[model samples]
Target: MSDVRTPTALPTTTIGPADEPATVGAIGYGAMSIAGTYGAIADADVTAVLDASIEAGANLIDTANVYGDGRSEQLLGRYLAGRRDDVVLASKVGIVNGGGIGKRGIRGDRAYIHEQIDLSLGRLGTDHLDLYYQHRVDPNIPIEETVGALAELVTAGKIRRIGLSEATGDELRRAHAVHPIAAIQSEWSIVSRDIETYVVPTAAELGVTVVAFSPLSRGLFTDSFGPEDVHLGGTRANFPRFQPEHLGANLELAAHFRSLAHRLGTTSEALAIAWVHDRAEQLGARVVSIPGTRSVAHLHANFEALQLELSDETRAEIDGYAARVSGPRASDPNWVSGGREGLI
Candidate 1:
């Protein structure tokens, strides 16, 4: 589908469990938090985390071309430089040319996408990327044009698989028509359930996996946020929910989730991850979760989430916390994502 140059061999790794656990991972790493935000991470640190993830049994790594203006991929490339056969190396294009603060634009025109594949391959130091996604849908460009171009990548062997991020159901169908979307990367945590109404079902019918990002509610579900936790060195600082006034209210809601977890004999983080997996499955969707973290211990904790299963009554309890509230996801509409009318 895309003529973007690809690596010679495909990585033989999968992110989900063999049985499709109620939650996606047995263990997955979030390289973003450790290295810093979507910006700079030293090659040494990236090398270390890559080692840690494999030791922890994580087979996948998620990153974007705009991360550290491609520094994240560079680090990952260096880490995976020689071990290419061992992991599922996933990266994206479209969200490019961001400022130092991680503010960037999404461009998915065919020509731009072709050039981006080359750039991502160069930064990632791979010929054939296992999975490639449109980091953000460009509103100015049609979804078909963007996905059609991606489909060509699949045909050309540049990208073994294709996915879309921040797309609506209609957009997904338009894209899938041109190519089979292996996944749709969107914020599908317990808090961000908008995809439930349409996107999830649409993806299910197409047999495309829902690659849920931010499954931890940006660490709010960990029962770790405090008044002092505000303004940490990442996008959470600018998020509306992390604002001083909303922090307490949001944490209160998070505490309710935590309380339910306690009654169920699990941590709130595990409960949150389980709920996302179950929610999509109830609707017949296949989910692949990537909750980014710098710590392997936390990665193990997240892996434990796979063992969690709530009955209908308990599912309702968890759903109650999310259904009743509308919290701040972004500080401004501009950075919220997908930048399309009525999509967010």
Candidate 2:
């Protein structure tokens, strides 16, 4: 039997500009999985998870326009029809389907950002998003121009605050100069710490919140995960860490991490969350981790991490394990900030 606990409110953290900071739950709900990123989930299950998350005070809902090509936002639109005020709604622009079949790329031009914001608003059924993000930085476009467009949205009442996903230290600095960046979304789990070297310190210096995505390394740290799970299909199939060549070695590292969690009397998922939280404190950065799930039990279980504190020895061991994990964070490192910044 699963150890299910009663849902409780997540502690709050402030995001956005200093004068107009918006308070949101520290543990936000990532809506990527429901977009069939993992697999096809029933509409009813999706509704259940969203309802449960918001009810538990995990009201900072994060989604992207490219997620299922707006299917995810449409689902959230229906769910938010009557409950719009309850969530600190967030969505992204920039990353979209490219010219060719199955091709994907970034689009951060002024006209494109303007067009995408309205489309996202229509899909979300909201006049304005509490927080908006550039899903990925466009190498062809200047970060200043992208942020300038977002700043116009803030002035036009289309978005209250702006954020950037997978942005480098330099990009964040450049973007913030044009407009105060509220948050930065990046992959920051025990297994993916590439952002810590430069992006984190820059964000801390600028007072931008670190919104950690895939904090569990896309279920790699979970108890039920196995090599067979990735073979079943979805985005994980495209991830290098889950490929046959690296799967065994990564799983071995995961096993050792799981054993540590067991000794601490907690699930690996919970410990992973706690580690991100601990790392944030250690680095003097405000962080909010958005871990996605189709199961309400898993969501509640994730909140358990808020109460789990790691000792210095445990944190050091986890870092050691992270260092030994084989493979890059993704198949196309260029698609991520760490890669663009030459970290990977």
Q: Write the per-residue lDDT of candidate 1 for residues 1-344, one digit (tens) a residue.
A: 21112222211233222342122233355555644673344556556666766765566677887766676777777777789867777788887664543466779899998998999899778898877899878879988899889878878889877878878878888888876777788877777777777788888887777888889878888845555645555567666677676777887887787787777777777778877777876998777677876544666567656666668787766776655445545444444333333444
Cα-based lDDT at residue 223, candidate 2: 80
- State residue 96's C-alpha deviation in candidate 2, in Å: 1.8
TM-score of each: 0.85, 0.95
Q: Write the per-residue lDDT of candidate 2 for residues 154-244, one digit (tens) a residue.
A: 9999999999999999999999999999999999999899999999999999999999999999899988788878955367867888888
Q: In order, what is each prediction's RMSD in angstroms? A: 7.9, 3.0
Model 2, backbone clash pairs (residues 3+ apart or across chains), number? 0
Show where candidate 2 strays beyond 4 Å.
1-9, 99-102
Model 2 lDDT at residue 114: 94
